[model samples]
Each structure stands twice: as structure tokens, then as C-alpha cells.
Target: MKQKIAVLGPGSWGTALAQVLAENGHTVKLWGHNPAQIDEINTYHTNRHYLPNIKIPTSIKGIKELKEAVIDVDAILFVVPTKAIREVAKEVAISVNTKPYIIHASKGLEQGTHKRISEILSEEIPESKRQEIIVLSGPSHAEEVAVHDITTITAASEKLEAANYVQDLFMNDYFRIYTNTDVIGVETGAALKNIIAIGAGAIAGLGFGDNAKAAIMTRGLAEISRLGVAMGADPLTFIGLSGVGDLIVTGTSVHSRNWRAGNLLGKGKKLDEVLENMGMIVEGVATTKAAMELATSLNVDMPITKTIYNVLYEGKDIHQAAKEIMLRDGKVENEFS
Candidate 1:
């Protein structure tokens, strides 16, 4: 069955997701704050700046007004940045009167609050107005997903029915979706991998070879799994798509903003300069701090995450941070999360 979907965010991920819905024969309204981007999506069917090579389907209309885009829609898919999730949900609260499935593909915990995107949506949007909050995430890169490259992601919800519904909404020949009941594992795995991607990028920027990338990704998975298990997630979920799969793609891909930012940071660029140069949200910068705090509160030991936090926040030398990490006492790999 066709549905009316509102996608909030016109950046790379949002635009690509809107294309998926349009290709699935759903009515899509892509909402954004930038007038020029909105105009390009509607008039030219191209979002050249964010997605340079792909053309948006004409069935996907671009709308400037949040209310205009979401009103009467069967589902609202938030592809915005982590920080913008709450603000957009607040608008959805007052704008839509009917029940619509509230879904989010944005991955990151709230910087200061350590809340997941679904939590922010739940806090802002009343349940009476929505079916359920669902999370869509995995190792997908918008550049590739937009081009119809083979990709698989997970849709998670507390309820199996909600997860299945989301899976059905998105699955296709090239784009596949799997349903999971472990929302915590899926969201944390999705969010924490960005930090590891930064580490992987930093290693590459420092002229390290594939050995360094593999080391960080492997150890990074351990630490990410540690934190996830501590936070009440099933440890097995960390080994699945949202966990190891996402880590591989985001940490290694040039298309990841977090990796790019980390690459610049490893190349001796300051945080502000790296962020400015990327022209997109490097979620790891903020996620590092939040994850550090969360780890502390949970008594979860994340050595790699801690080192990245010190380098990013305290301006510690990356080489020294790397040295410190290397000097740490070794541990039995199988015992922790």
C-alpha cells in the first residue's frame, strides 16, 4: 500500500531516503530550512550540493513549511541531524492531528542529555498523535544508497509489528531492511560507531596503513559493545549490521563526515577548522563527549573512546593520545561487553 511520508531534512541522507520512498511509489514531501535546497529539489529534482550525482524523483515534493509537509502524512521520517530531532518533533506535535508513524533515521545521542533520537521524539511528540517511534539505521552511505547500490539496514522498535511495518515500507531489490526488537542495541551501535569512524579516519590521516584501521575497528567494536551492553542492550546486537557492519562502512568510507573530520583532526587541523571544512555534521565530535559521560555513569570502560574524547575536548596531542592508548594494560578480550 502507498503512503504519504514526510521526510524532515534535505541533506544527503534525508534526500536519499526520500528518493527510496518515492521509488517505492509513496508520496514524499521533503522538508528543509534552506530555500535554495528546497527549490532545487522541487524545480530541478536535484540536490546537487548534498547529493551531487543523483536526481531526486519528481514525485518527491520539496516543502519549506514543516506543518505543510507533515500534516496528514501517514509517516514522518526524520533524517535530520541528532541535534535537530527535538526541534523538528516539537513542530510535528502541533502540526499533525492524526496518528502517523514517528520514525527516525538520525543516529546520535543528544550531546548533553545522552538521549537517543527516539527518546527525543517521544519527549516532544505525544503518543496520541503517532503510531509508534521506530529507528532506521545501519551502514548506509547516502552517496551509495542514492545510486541504488546494494545496502542493508535495520529497523528497530520495541514492538515487533512496528518493526515489521517499517521493514516492509523500505525493502526492495537493492535496499533491504531487517527488523529487530532490540532498539537500544541498534541505536547505540549506530551512534557509537561514528566515534570509531573518527578514530579510523584519524589513523589514516596520520599516515597509518590498513593495519591501523583494522586494529581500531576491531578494538573499537569491543569498546562499543562494552558500552552497549552496559547500557542494557543485548550484546549480540553489536555483532550485527547496526554494530560491526556500520563500523566497517562509516569508519572506512570517505563519505562519512565523522571520518572526514577525524582525518583532518589527525592531519593537525583544529576541531573548529575541521568542522568548517567538512560543511556537514561530524557527529563524533559531540558524540565523543556524551559517550564518555555515559560510560562514566555506567562504569563502562571505553579506552579508545576516552582517548578520542581527550584529543577532541582537551586538545591533547593525537600522537600522545595514541601512545597512551597503546601503553594501557592488555585485557582478556572475551570477558567484557
Candidate 2:
């Protein structure tokens, strides 16, 4: 069945998703704050700044106004930055008259509140105006997905019916969606892996080889699972697509903003300078602080996360932080036991 969907945010991920939906035969309303971007998408059928050289389907309509985008949509996909989740949800709540399925593809935790993107959406959007909240996440990147590269991801929700609905909406020849009920595990894994990715990028930036990167990724997954399990997530979910799968892609790819930011940091650039140069949000930088706070409150020993947080926020030297992580007391590999 065809449906009208509102895809909020005109970033690369959002644009790529809109294309997918349009290709799937849905009427897509692609929303953005910038009128110029909206105009470009509407007039040229392209979002050059975000998804350059990619042609947006004519079925997708670009809308600058938030209310205009959500007015009669059957579902809303929040693809904005983590910080913008609440603000956008509130606006959507005010705009909609009927309940719509809420789906978010953004991956990050709120800075001060330490809340996941789905949590922020639930809090800000009135329950009366929302049906089911679904999270679509995994190792999929917008750049690859835009060009129809084979990609797989998890669509997780407490409601299996909702997850299946999202799966049906997105599944295609080159795109695959697996349904899961572990929203906590999926969201936690999606947000925390970026911190580890920053460390991986740092390893590359410092001229370290694959061994160091592999170690960081492995230990990083351990820490992510520890904190996630402590917070009521299923332990096994961390090994799945949203967990280890996401960590591998985000930590190693040049397409990852967090990894790119970490690379600059490792190459002797300051945080502000690195962020300025990238001209995009590096979610791991903020997520590192939130994860560090959450780990301390939960008494979870996340040494790698702690090290990354210190380097990002406390003026600690990256080399010293890396050394500290390397010199931490050795123990049995299976800390989960």
C-alpha cells in the first residue's frame, strides 16, 4: 500500500532515505530548515550539498516548513541531529491531528540528559499523536545507500507489527531490513559505537596499523555491551547488526563524521578546529561525554570510552590517553562473566 511519509532533515542520510521511500512508491515530503536546500531539492531534484551527484526521485517533494511536511503524512522519520530531536518532535506534535508512526534514524544520545534519540521523541511528542516508535539503524551509510550499494539494517520497536511495517516499507533488492524487538540494545549500540569509531580514526590518524584498530574495536564493543546490559538492554543484541555491525562500519569508514573528527584530533588538531573544518556534526564527541557520565553513574568500567572522553573534553593529550588505555590493569577477556 502506498503512503505519504514525512522525512525530516535534509542531510545525506535523510535525503538517501527519502530516495529509498520514493523508489518504493511512496509520496515523500523531505523537510529541511534551509530554504535554499529545499529549493534545490524541489527544483533540481538533487541535494548537491549533502548527496552530491545523486538524483532525487520526482516523487519526493521538498518542504521547508515543518508543519507543512507533517500535516497529512502517515509516518514521520526524524533524521535530524540528536540535539534537534526534541525540538523537531515538539513541532511535529503541534502539527499533526492524527497519530503517525514515528521513526528515527539518527544515532546519538542527548548530552545533558543522556537520553537516546527515541527516548527524546517519546518525551517531546504527545503519545496521543504518535502510534508506534521505530528505530532504523545499523552499519548502513548514506553515501553507499544512495548509490544502491547492498545494505542491511535493523528496524527495532517494542511493537513487532510496527517493526514489520518499517521493514516492508524499506526492504528492496539492494536494501534489507531485519526486524528486532530490542529497542534498548539497538539504540544503545547505535549511539555508543561512534565513540569507539573516533578512537579507531585516531589510531589511523596517528599512523597505527590494523592491529591497534582491531583491539580498540573489540574492547570498545565490550564496554558498549557492559553499559548497555547495565541499563536493561539484551546482552546478545550487541553482537548483532546495530552492535558490532555498526561499530565496524562507523569506526572504519571515511564517511563517518565521528571518525573523521577523531582523525583530525589525532593529527594534532583541536576539537573546535576539527569540528569547524568538517562543517558537520560529529556525534561521537558529544556522545563520549554522555557515555562517560552514564558509565560513572552505572559503575560500568569503560576504559576506552573514558579515555576518549578525557581527550575530547578535558584537554588531556590523545597520546597520554591512548597510553593509559593500553596500560590499564589486565584481566580475563570475558568481563561479562
User: lDDT (CA) for every model shown?
Assistant: 0.91, 0.92
lDDT by residue for model 1 (1-337), tens:
9899999999999999999998999999999999988988889999998998787899999999999999889999999899888888898999996799988999899988999888899999988989989999999999999999999999999998999888988988999999999999999999999999999999998899998899899999999998898888999998899999999999998999999888988899999888887888888888999999999999988999999999999989998888889899877777274
- Model 2 per-residue lDDT tens digits across residues 197-314: 9999999988899999999999999999999999899999999999999999999999998889888889999998998888778889889999999999989999889888889889
Model 1 lDDT-worst window of ten: 328-337
Candidate 1: C-alpha lDDT: 0.91
TM-score of 2: 0.98
Worst 10 residues of 2 by lDDT: 328-337
The C-alpha RMSD in Å for every predicted model, in order, reads: 0.9, 0.9
Rate residue 151 of model 1 by lDDT.
98
Best by lDDT: 2
Reference-based TM-score of each model: 0.98, 0.98
- Please give the distance, in angstroms, between residue 199's alpha carbon in candidate 2 and its true position after superposition: 0.4
